[model samples]
Target: MPIYSSDSDSYDVSSSSTRLFQRERPLHSILGGGRVADVLLWRKKNVSAAILLGLTVIWCLFEVFEYQFLTLLCHIAITVLLFIFIWTNGASLLNRSPPKIPEIILSASAFKQVAVTFHAELNRSLIVLYDIACGKDLTLFLLAIASLWILSVVGTYFSSLNLMYLGFVAIGTIPALYERYEHEVDYLAGKSNRDLRKLYKKFDSKVLNKIPRGPIKQKKSK
Candidate 1:
């Protein structure tokens, strides 16, 4: 003979419900899970979509409402007002000791630091060029340069809005599609690589190898 309490029945029901939810978790993940949620919330690559959306809105406003002069006026007014407010009340708001600019931000030292950084980066770039010219990455380096030249020329012909749309579409869809069909994509890419390598070898032998070479420089006695 057993006495069954209502609370025990409720506890059993709750436990069963929890187990059911746990079972559905994987189904939820298979459909569209946390990664999709994060993308919808504009994480990482979705940020570009968000920016493109913002630009699209601005372009619409400019085109539809003729907001050019109004936009300029609003910008100027807001900047002036903010500047005045800061100039007038900044001291009281800060209420701290003398607010001198940091030594790093000061004119001469900052300029020197910038100059040094610029020269360091310039030297690094020269070293990279030398390595590319001397090493096996020369073909990749030339391809990159040619790609940049083509991109610049294409960009000059296309309007900013067109380029933005292209970027938005590519950034939004390409990664997700690639992730979804990665194996198939890889298979296709491997096939393409084989074909390209064959073509490259044929071209090098027939066309490039026959190009006239410059006279080799003989080393002079020191």
Candidate 2:
């Protein structure tokens, strides 16, 4: 019975994943499954996208022959640089000045659909939050799995995986910290206002009653 249940669960999980990858969005990607983001992200200059497509074609042709490390490196390098340029510019495009605030936020929402780093961080947060909310045993189990995965990857890929690990950690932590800082400012402002109100009431009831009069006009004369 237990084995049958496990098999059923496994099938359900795989089906869900397959469905998710099959979905589509306009430009960036088709709901995270990855797509040609011509309309979504690459709406501007076509030059970069054209070059990337060209290189991808070449890479594919090479791959048909065999997996050449040089070809792999060339393709990966181009893709990585492409992403860096896009993200750096995308951040600005996502959050323009107050005049285009609405448009910017909307773009960010759309961007999130294809933003791989954002998705990865969100998934990480969900896993951690779930473990914390569930129970200590579950949390420990998750931690063990996470630690083992990191150890194995880093051990097996000392050079490449090390950079990937650092990149993920940095990207995940930075956004979260920015969110916390914004919240902290809001909290402090609220707390200060609340404390000020209490002090006014506690010290002098008339304080609230007094009119906040402007500067008294000096009696003309003397």
Candidate 3:
């Protein structure tokens, strides 16, 4: 449809005109991305930190010989720590890379493999850190054996019996110990995977940057 304008400059009052009108109009509606992931991430860290703090306090009490509540507090503390560490690191490590077309086209197995790989690496890193820190506690088991030996040789055979018994005792701590080990492994895995994911995200051409939703125009400084 041809529309005539009497003015010197003619504007095509069609699709182009509608576009110009849209360009001039300001957005009254709010724009936002979903915060579900971000909120969950924050909760992951905060809850983990809170758990760790509480566990530390309980362990301190346990060390002070608070026998009345030692076993309960100690086990609970370790359990909570275990869960928190796994969650905090897991959430961070699991990167949402833009889907790869070939992989999706060829097989879903490729996507499954990607998830497995990310999890494996994160778990490995967490274990390494856990092993290093808990090593000292593990050493206590060895030291207990040594102390028991010296007691048997120098003192009466039964005099240091209780202390010697504790040498074999930390065997009870093994599960909690391993739990810590696993926690650290997860952390390490996540950290390493996250770094690798970041590198991949930066280099991958398919992952395009989103543009601002508005007309582009050159602005001059006043």
Clash counts for the predictions, in order: 0, 1, 13
Ranking by lDDT: 1, 2, 3
Poorest stretch of ten by lDDT in candidate 1: 12-21
**Each candidate: RMSD to true structure?**
17.8, 23.2, 29.7
lDDT of 1 by residue, 134-221 (tens): 7566445665688889989999988766676677666556656655554455444544444667777899999999999999999999
| Candidate 2: Cα lDDT at 119 | 82
Best by lDDT: 1
In model 1, the clashing pairs are: none
- Once superposed on the true structure, which residue ranges of model 3 sit more than 4 Å away at CA? 1-45, 66-222
* Local distance difference test values of all predictions, in order: 0.60, 0.51, 0.48
Error of 3 at 43 (Å): 7.0
lDDT of 2 by residue, 32-138 (tens): 32332332233333644465455556545554455567867888999978877777777777884322235766786678765976788699879966776576664
Runs in model 1 lying further than 4 Å from the true structure: 1-52, 62-135, 214-222
TM-score of predicted structure 3: 0.17
- Candidate 3 residue-wise lDDT, 38-152, digit = tens: 2222334565445445555655455445544657767889997887677666765776343223656678796788788679868986875576557655433444567768866
